[model samples]
Target: MSDKYAVPNKLPAKQVNVMTHRKRRLREEESHHRVKRLNRSFKLRSKKRDYKKPEFFITQYLKAERDSKRMRRVIMKNNFLKGVDDEEPKLLVVMHHRAHRVASKECTLIMNSMGLNRLHNTVLLKNTTESLALLKMIEPYVVYGYPTIQTVRDLIFKHGFLRIKGKRTAINSNKLIEEHLGEHGCICIEDIVHDLFTVSDNFKNVRSLLLPFSLKAPRDGWSKKIGVSYSRGGEYGNRKHEINALIERCL
Candidate 1:
């Protein structure tokens, strides 16, 4: 056969290189799978050890029940004392300070129900026994206290927003207020502040029109970690009347 037309007895250098590359890739893939298999085996062994027994969950449930009862007692006692003195708070300002990552499903539900789904969001709630009970259950995730009249006024004037038709709108004019809340007798911003501060019958209607107040971090920063209770020098839990001071800094 003519040399030009004859097939080569040995493969070209390029073909040899391509074959070697394919073999190298196969080896690498094999090694990767081996490593993954080893890792998966180790993980399985660790998971076996980490698995919690049913008894462990039972103990956890019992502990939670005990804590719930204890908290209920404390709330009832405080409410009783306040009632005796006619000093029970009419309204409470609750601020959500922590993130949902650390909150349980129950706490998240309560916070959402109270319009406190975001960090640093504040809402005004009537200080009913049921409300207090729910707050105590999620005490670790919120800061609450009785807001003064001035604080109520400032919050409504400064941070107050309305969720009109699912849109967040500022309280810029009395007309907007009258449009949404005139029937409830809250015809203006001042009416909202007055109703909220006095916990009047129109309070719930006014609150329904307003969105949760989104506040800034305090100018001086939190006194301690956000997870700590206010009584323990942290920002969470009830701050009593001190919430007004916190609100001022945030505003």
Candidate 2:
């Protein structure tokens, strides 16, 4: 009875080998699953790192390139169109208002409606009959003129911005212009220049879509007397083509 219970405690060698093999297989399976989990976690971490990469420098470089090309095209176009329309009288007008001095309520209302609520704030508009009437109504508080092609080009290229969702967004890329004004055939800055310069049918849309330009007081400074007309050497009223010189100095 004792032998039956205790003498057979050691198993056969074949049985022992089979048990050892089964334990090794279980350990190998656990190691394989752990390796797979570690690889998946590493891949997820790499994706997050890729998403964090900064694009600021690339954007700035692209902007610089676009500006350079646009400037060259503007220069060529201006050269070709020069002298041909010197006397044709451009309808593209530049306007700025003197807000320091008191103005009549009627004049103030007109100026504000035209978005000339601040001093040295500039706006470009097509010289239509209605616009002419508005200008005359607030003539005493504003200075206006027929800007040259160069003036218009410089203003839009250097200081131009788009009115996007009621915000003043700078014209950094043609992509941005296309995104907003594509339907009007204004997919790039060049299209804007053409529309504004030619006073095309889409001029109203293009002009209205622009943010009002805020310019520095001309480097030459303004006259102390804001009440007099520009022709008489004061700051207010129209200067006609002479406005180009004033804007250039400010630029």
Candidate 3:
């Protein structure tokens, strides 16, 4: 009865070999499945990483903005060159009417670059393509127009200040003018007014000497709504020759 319940001492060699081969095959299959699972997990992790990247539409918008700006610059250059070849450049009186609190950082930087730091501050700029382009960019915040000689002269004599040694100094004497702009042939206030009015070759040098003119609000207050175009019955944007009248009122 004991012998009937007992197992054989050893199995046949072929049987043992077959069992060993089967175990090895099972182990290999398990290892292959494990490797496949790990690969699938890695792929899923990569997919998640890609999803965490910046949105496609946001990148597209940024790319479009960049392209538009580049195209705008090219257009501005062409227009400026054409104007230069056709006729004399005009002087544009650009006035900043808006406050900085509501302005974008880019607009503020453009204003700062043009020396329009304060409200109602006006700068005399050449009607070059670059200037016109910048004006177009900040049109909603500022007003600009062609100024008559009389208007330019009055603005310089009445409200013009000089940026000297990093300080705002009043234009008092030709001697002071000579001290700063002598090399540029602008020895007197008249020279500056002439250069500015005519938009001459020395215009840039003369403009560099003068600070933006600070003017009062129009005497009767703004005739039209603020922040609207002149054509739309507002005081902002290009008022053309009508800017002289506005400057007169402010003065």
Candidate 4:
């Protein structure tokens, strides 16, 4: 938390490098696995720990695949819009998690090239926070971050998920509403999914999480600051750089 991110006051970097840290972690994990396998094969290890396929691990892998499908779907719908042949296509942005500025800008630039506009249509958010993961902050999203139904179940059942930034996020709603809801059973069916189709390229499940989406837009100044004007200066500058780079690459 101490080491904050400052966007270096220049044209923003691209998203291609956002996962560098995560990729390093993955490589480390792979190395560890290889060493473990070698030890088991050679005489260096005494106890032969049999590779038991745990159902929990299986569940997590499935969850990641599911989330990825959902993500791609969200991306296609919001960003690479399907219906319009003539008009500018809307871009869908699937933020797997809290992406850094460079990643966000690169994603926006990519969508624009695919005939979609970042200022409209794209949606970026953490899928697991509120429902899919249904647990705590999901620190594993980076390296230790492993997504699974079992891990989520543990978070909800073991930890009651009472604090803010848990598996899900509650927007600027009344605290009294939360307290009262906590005291009693309630039902809030966010109906937008049914009304409007949302495909998740990551998860592949199109849940109706519309109320928050609708509510969040106006609150996020969507109604007022839309079109090209809504693009923030820093993000826009980065988008410009990314676009030029993309064009140069194509050439």
lDDT score for residue 128 of model 3: 76
> Each model's RMSD to truth, in Å?
8.4, 20.6, 19.2, 29.7
The local distance difference test score of each candidate is 0.82, 0.73, 0.81, 0.31
Q: Write the per-residue lDDT of candidate 2 for residues 39-80, one digit (tens) a residue.
A: 999988777453433585566566546545644554565433
Error of 2 at 117 (Å): 1.1
Write one digit per residue (lDDT tens) for candidate 3, span 147-180: 9999999998899898899999999899999999
Worst 10 residues of 1 by lDDT: 77-86
* Residue clash pairs of candidate 3: none
Mind giving the per-residue lDDT tens digits that candidate 1 earns over 116-208? 888889999988777877888778778899999999888888988998999999999999999989888878788888889888999878888
What count of clashes does model 4 give?
A: 33
RMSD of 3: 19.2
Candidate no. 1 TM-score: 0.66
The estimated TM-scores of all candidates read 0.66, 0.60, 0.65, 0.16
Q: Which 10 successive residues of model 4 have the least lDDT summed?
A: 135-144
Model 2 residue 177 lDDT?
90
lDDT-sorted candidate list, best first: 1, 3, 2, 4
Largest lDDT belongs to which candidate?
1
| lDDT digits (tens) for residues 1-251 of candidate 4 | 34367445554456546567779989999999999899877864676667756985676566656545655565555432323333321222221122222122334454333223322222222322232221111111211122233322222222221223333443334352334342332121121121122222411221222111110121222222121211352212113123222222211
TM-score of 3: 0.65
